[model samples]
Target: MASYGGVAVSGGMPRFSDTLINGGVILEPWAGIRAYASYAEGYTVPDVGRIARAVGTAGVDIDDYVNIEPIVSNNREIGVELKRGPLDASAAYFWSTSKNGSLLVQTAIGAPFEIQRQRVEIEGLELNLSVKTPLPGLTLSTGYAHLIGRTDGSANGIDVVDRDLDGANISPDRLNIAASYVQGSLSARIQTQFFLSRQFERTPNAYPALYRFDGYDTTDISLRYQTGFGALSLSAQNIFDSFYIDYYSQTVRPNDNAHYFAGRGRNFTLSWDYRF
Candidate 1:
């Protein structure tokens, strides 16, 4: 990816390019068990002058601007799966670390700029399970993930937490479940996701607090008819059109006065596909 654009807040011109390569391998050493691992590397150009100028406007004082260096990261993960009869389960652990990490730092003046001197580390675990029963048209699937991140190096004469240390904006834990049923040409499915409240550190004296939002549950039903000319189907999303905030950002004042991004209300679609 390459971008040639000027900073909106600052008048400085910015340019960047990145190349990424990722690959993985899988091996089966025994019955009902398989293992896999993968790695990826990324190289990118940095615009240090643009970043410095932005940060300077944010109330930081710097005598000179320095060009940023390329950023790099290394990631590795291993996992195994087990299958038996009508049930299957899998789990994996992953760790990733980055050097010369590029991040936008905000200064007291509220100016934000990119910096490539920072380092970051992240680790996570994931688990998935699926079961199919003999009972006609019955299938269930569920999964969970937990992630933690932190800075690998010190910054601004303070020990910053590796993960969004300045704020509580990290998506740490997630749970999801999905089930589907089919009878002849008719099918129905229900899926729901739950995200734990996120914690943010508002002040040095005060501990982080979790902001809560109602969990999400959505159901979709669809029917398709087979025809000589084509096939037509209809579907609906968010059938209930639950009223809730999908996302939000905090304000300087510790109040919930932040604007909320609304989720999709009730929506329907009809699709047709034909083969010549």
Candidate 2:
């Protein structure tokens, strides 16, 4: 992949271009198992929309635009899957490194926006399991993932832990379990997702670890029925009414109390579907 763009400045328009390559492979030599491995290289440019909004605003600097650089990354992963009888399982490990990775940084204290560059290293593991019970049309599935990331170099004058790290915004651990049943024209499913606690910066200017959002889980259920005319469906989201803060809301703070965007409470929806 490749991209080209320019920023208007007093001197001239600074232009940039980036290229990326990606590929992967898989092998299945046994009836119940398969193995796979993959590698990829990619890059990203700054968000021009956000930059446009900041232009001419107080405390915003044109140098912010000049400092922006394309972020590049190299990633690799390997994993295996197992399938036997009514049971299936899989696991994988992945590692990635980013060059000039862009992160929210405080150009100065209380700055609303700033982008810093760093070399970042990230690694993680993922797992999944599923089983189909003898019970007619019933299945259970579960999955989990854990990740960790840190700055890769020391030239930026900040310790890996002091950079208001962006990775901290991501929940390091997550789990999801679900059950489904299907018979005739009727189907139903229920699921729950758990998020492990993570650290976050209240503002792009603050140390990334200044605050934390306690982990929380939410549940949802759905049911559907089909008739000669059309299908009817009902869904209950956040069935448990559990509350949580998503990643984005935690990263930026207009005020101390406003840092979190509360998770939605329980809600319901019903709908009809027809095909011509």
Candidate with the greatest lDDT versus the true structure: 2
Candidate 1 lDDT over 1-276, as tens digits, reads 012233333333444567777999999898888999999886665665555444423333332233354667888899999897888999999987766665544343332334535666678999999898787777898999987666633455554543443333235477888887776655666777666445543334444454333345455555666567787878787777776555333322233343335567889989998978
Quote the lDDT for 243 in model 2. Answer: 67
Residues 1-276 of candidate 2 have per-residue lDDT tens digits of: 011123333333456776778899999999989999999997777655444444443444444454465667899999999999999999999998876675554343344554445666778999999999999899999999988766633465653533334533344479999999999999999999888776644333454454554578899999999989999999999998876766555544423464447878999999999988
The C-alpha stretches of model 1 lying farther than 4 A from their native spots are 1-27, 38-68, 104-117, 152-154, 157-172, 183-185, 201-227, 248-259
Models 1 onward score TM values of 0.67, 0.77
Model 2 weakest lDDT span, ten residues long? 1-10
lDDT score of residue 267 within candidate 1? 90
Clashing pairs in 1: 58-109, 58-111, 149-163, 150-162, 150-163, 151-162
| Top candidate when judged by TM-score against the true structure | 2
**Candidate 2 collision pairs:** 164-208
